[model samples]
Target: MHLLEGVAAILVSVCIYAWAYGKHHGPGAPGWAKGQLFASLISVLLVALFPVGAGFVALGLTEAMTPASWAGLVALAVLPVAIWKAVPRLARRA
Candidate 1:
């Protein structure tokens, strides 16, 4: 379903962003922090659309054009800021 795929996409993107953040921001990775955020955001946007692609194929394009898809689009649009705030806290826990 679109909901499930959307949720999965968001979760995976956050995890990827978190990992990239932690990696580039680590102590030994000096001067790399400046570009890490952009790299992480680009990575998330490029990678997270896979599940939605599957949803389109699984449900058919016509069927997929529903409220859930709209919500997914909004969620994807908000994802960068969410990950920006959340990933730091999550990294601190680890």
Candidate 2:
């Protein structure tokens, strides 16, 4: 059950991150979105794997992260603006 929950959390987090990335980057989003999703997924997975990390994440959530997560959630909430800002710079160098 614990393993299942961990897997579910990883899946959910990846999906959320990918959805945010896609919304920001649009249908034509670059590989960087995937990279960010992967990075987020790895971070969560690492937390799940390490009991200490999991405790810290839980504590952080209870204290600092609740607010920070809201900010991140808001940032993700406005992904289109981020995409608009990022795509041009990405295009310029390429």
Candidate 3:
């Protein structure tokens, strides 16, 4: 079940990321927007690791992760949104 869930998360995340990239990363997009899009892609990719790791741990291939690790993963998942909002403002001031 964990493995299946992890697979689903990966599939969904990748599909969404790919759609967003295609929509927002056209030639006319600003450098800041492209940068943010890539940043969000990285953030979401890292976020997807949590489920994969969980699946691994469930299968006893690895030990459980620390609470801080889990918290950090959650933080990374949210970081993209923060970057998305902050980068434009910073670019304008530059």
Off by over 4 Å in 2: 27-94
**Best-fitting candidate, scored by TM-score:** 1
Name the better of 2 and 3 by TM-score. Answer: 3
Top lDDT hit: 1
How do these models rank on TM-score, best leading?
1, 3, 2
For model 2 the local lDDT of residue 41 reads 66
> Candidate 3: where are CA atoms >4 Å away?
28-32, 37-47, 50-94
Task: Please list the C-alpha lDDT of all candidates, in the order they appear.
Answer: 0.61, 0.48, 0.52
Q: List, residue by residue over 1-94, the lDDT tens digit for candidate 1.
A: 4653655565665666666667666666546555866676657685656556446435533464677666766665676777677777755523
Inter-residue clash pairs, candidate 3: none
Off by over 4 Å in 1: 1-4, 16-64
- In model 2, where is the ten-residue run with the lowest total lDDT? 1-10
Better of 1 and 2 by lDDT: 1
TM-score of 2: 0.31
Model 1 clash pairs are: none
TM-score of each: 0.42, 0.31, 0.36
How many clashing residue pairs appear in each of the predictions shown?
0, 0, 0
Weakest ten-residue segment in model 1 by summed lDDT: 53-62
